[model samples]
Target: MVSRAHPHGDDDIRLLGDDSFEQSDEKDNLISFDDTSGLRHRGPSSSHKKPLSAARSVSPSSAQDSPKGPVVAVFVVVFDAKQGNRIEWSHTVDGSVDIGGVEYKALPSGAHTVSSDSLTFKIGSYYGVAYFRTETDKSSARGAVFRSCGLLGRRLEDIVGFRTVLQSELSQGKHSTGDYHVLEDLVGGRSDFVDNAFTPVMERVNKSEIELMHDNKIVRDFCTLLGADIFRLWKCVLLRKRILILGTPPFADLCHIAHLCSLIGNYDISSPLRPDYNLLLYVDLNDIDKLRQSKTFVACTSELIYQLKNDCYDVLIMKNQLHIQDPALQRTCLTSAMEKENFSELMHDYNLRSSIMHVDSGRFDATEFVGGYFTALNEKILSAFHAADCTAEQTIADSALEDLSLNPASDVPFLQALANMHCPSIRVQRQPLCPQCHLC
Candidate 1:
């Protein structure tokens, strides 16, 4: 004998055909999105028009006890640019309108629908039902089945469709990669880390709340027109800078290249602060004074220095003149100065000194002009110069003559050159006391 324990027994089953249900009952809990005209009538202003008799007839307690049927409330959370979540819409079972208070619970014993306002979803409908005897059993059984069926049937289709549309639209732009060669060239030869670094930054800019709000507001106003967010393009500018700074290229070389790029009327990268500028540099307080005094240097730092203080890791400013007293103002002036060709020359001379020093010119090496050489020379000359200046002229002359007598050979060239000028020679010996010079 086999015992059947089917929870949904055949004898207890009931099926309501699509068209057989009463019109009011079928539409009772359903939200009519199509009734846009009358929705304004359901607002607070309309409540005042109802008769007082109708208002007094329904008691608050009785109304509370009365079966308030399942409600469906749709919530859309728009995020800011920096926020990371991607969910555009989400819904729950029971069709309840208790949006702020209740947590959405998935039904285990009955079927339900989940819908989103996102343009991605086409079905606008979903079906989920409870199974198994216990809550845990029902959850486990439904979850395992839901993973395969619900995801593929509903979620995946919308996601894939949305992504396909996005990719297609993106492909239409100037930087698009619709061609196989373009994609292959971008991905095939790049290192793993280089490729991975870009993925998160791109995802961040694309899914930012700023972009979503802009898109939604535009959609609301214009009906069917779509526009790409310009903010996402800023990410490319940032990525280019990162590549220049951290790529295998030397730092000095990259800075020089950036400087040159600014000179030729080609530094535009689309920023709100400075729309047609490429690079910005910030000078430290200690170095400002020296930079200001030099004819070859100008402090042209940006007033936009404060913007970089928060989000960015490193900041570069290009300018013509920088003031030591005000680092912030100097940054701003620098942006204005960046358009000049001479700014590149100044930056090369000041910033790229180490790189320039090693290159051969056959003249005196610039390395000798560094602070260390002057410091060593100062230490050697200061004490001896002070002693000589303090001593009497006669005493100094006598000391010099005594040293010359002890090492007369060293004085021979001096004596001969003085003799050539017809200066007096005191004495000459056949066998000189000094090894090389006869006059001592």
Candidate 2:
């Protein structure tokens, strides 16, 4: 229900890009969703021209038929080639209109925004973005013209970040070594490298908590932790799950250790730990912040409890004792690590399990839950979560679950942290299903 301010005339202005004028029978760039990230891309038959009917009008605020409440009307004034400017398809982003090969945006004179696959450049006071100018100023950079777009948009930082990521992607397999593209030679070189450098060092590793994928008969179920810098991953991997560093910085997705430690200072655990982290690399224990909570980190080879029931350390390295500090409850960072699919499945399980446990009467969402399956599930995660809970820490008996569970994201955290998780740079961990062990 569009309650336009003026219903009589075609006051609803419809602006078109320069391409609209160039091709009489063609349409403008149509944005469609890409499957990988649900990002928008320009389609071949793109033409967006919704003529505002003279009889129809939209409410200024909160139209009854609108599923999302509160709508604002923005006037779009398209800039064409006459102004020495044109909107072109951006390579770095899909469905975005930029000036040159990924330059500043040239939004309609009064439009609120023009967006791309993952960003929204919009107009705002003192720091608005999404504008363009015909002239360029040379003072900003070398041989570059300052085609003034509004400032303070996400594009300011996103452009640099996106470029860095894109450059890395494009530079893959760039043949910097000049291998001369010969399969026989490549295979021979690889064989030589393996014989001389790799095969000689292949020895039976000790205290193995993990086995090769081909060696293991059972399908390894995994949970994903992403690069979102959430605290839940810090605890689940470093503390409870004892995730092996299969990858590392400059090598692969580095663990979010910097963000983890800085969030709550160095870690102090009430439980003892003896980490059995056999490695090609050596990590300074002084740089390690969290202790493995499951007795010891000796890959569970021996059940002897961890020494130093309470130890504080700024970091962790081999053969290093923890620098004693006052015992403090580890921080959980109070961030959820939930993904939608896992959450939904877990909810079904939780509901069913709760019914059996006789705690299904008061159901749970991500926001808040008290004394039921949620509490049990929360405990399973909190114990595994190594980071200190930034908010109130809970005990299994009386601890509470406070999260943005009302949002769809709440579901995955329970699944990932409790279930041993999905997403990129995922961690595969052992699940505690043995009834003899304490409840997970």
Candidate 3:
């Protein structure tokens, strides 16, 4: 017969041994019943059959006696973008369960079911589940099954959109080739028959050959325009086409020349061209004192100027008091010089104002320094326009032209008008202009 002992004040009951069944402990409260034959006894009647083992006993602790439920194993999948694949699933549990022949312990007791899609687990008794999605599956297919379960609305789509946009923007533009019709006209003294003179000699020059030829032409023109003798030396150094400048030595001016070459080459006038030619500058000299305070300063500048000339660059040297006669050419050089300084504070504060004032005051021809500075400024202006964004190019060109216009002695107001209509500007300058056309 099954015997149960009740806790004095608790709902739980303890099962006692057959000997203890006859006497109730003060801590236990026992109730005895008669056998089915109807014979009464102090304990369970001997005639009554014992309860089946599974149901015979009750423990004082309900936790020990209650039937434990099945545990559900949950797998949470995570998509890994860097690896371009789906990573392994993370497992959780509603209760303990065996997975892949290994026992997982201490899961919350509940009815459990493995996910047919293999990426989820449902704890039926607890009404809980876990799920995840993979990156590849999310990208290629709209959605895929995970252990027979639908995996939808499980991943982020914004990242894909951003990447697509970025790639499209990066691959949209073409390379630059320096080609400017106006500059060619100015240099050759007439626009009537110059196109044929600059036409490609070969039907299709390879990219490298085109670059080399363009670089050589840029150096030659720059030196000649500056009235320097560097172009002759450049012809001699055909074997060493590349030139490296060790000090600052006005890099912005060279970049301007490069931009002019691009214009002449008919590069996309609307976009900034990536630099293709190599011109390395080393600014990190180990000796700080050797920079501007040494006797080597003047020597270094002279040597650099000589080398630049030898390399076929138009290297014009000016005493602080030199001047020039042609107003148009002077204006162009002034713009180029401004560009060479990369629009630095020094250019804006001193060179640009001084050049403009000299040209306006009709004092440019009085000093070689004024003439040289003007030439450099013109080159710098052209390069800046080339580097500006599509929308800002026209605006910047107009502003530059206006600056030139303020100087009555300057002679390129018509060209400035054309620039204002067609050129692009730096992207940052795309905000709407004021009624006065001022960039607000």
lDDT of the candidates, in the order given: 0.22, 0.23, 0.24
Candidate numbers sorted by lDDT from highest down: 3, 2, 1
What ranges in model 2 sit over 4 Å off?
A: 1-244, 248-437
For all predicted structures, in order, the TM-scores are 0.14, 0.18, 0.17
Model 2 lDDT tens row, 1-440:
11112112122222323332221111111111112221011111211211110012233332333222111111111232223223221111112322221121233221112221111222221111132322223542322221222112121211111222222222342223422222111111132211221121112121122322111111001111221222333333333333222111111001112111121111222223322221111121211233333222211100011223233222221111112122221222223333333344443453454354345443222111111222333333334443333224411111223231212222333434332321222232223332652222
> Candidate 3's residue-wise lDDT over 1-440, tens digit each?
11111112112211111221122232221111112111100111111111110012223352232222111222222222222112132222222332221101111001011111111111112212122111224543334222110111111110111112112221231101222222123121132321232211121222243433333333333333323212111211111122222222122222323223222212122323322222211111121233323221111121222322332222222321113223542332233232223223322333344356557853211112222333333334445555453342334433444343222222233234323433422321222334562211
lDDT of 1 at 211: 36
Q: Considering summed lDDT, which 10 consecutive residues are worst modelled in model 3?
A: 102-111
How much is 192 displaced in model 1, in angstroms? 20
User: Judged by lDDT against the true structure, how good is candidate 2?
Assistant: 0.23
Against the hidden true structure, what lDDT does model 3 obtain? 0.24
TM-score of 2: 0.18
Alpha-carbon RMSD, each predicted model: 34.7, 26.4, 41.9
Best by lDDT: 3
Cα-based lDDT at residue 173, candidate 1: 36
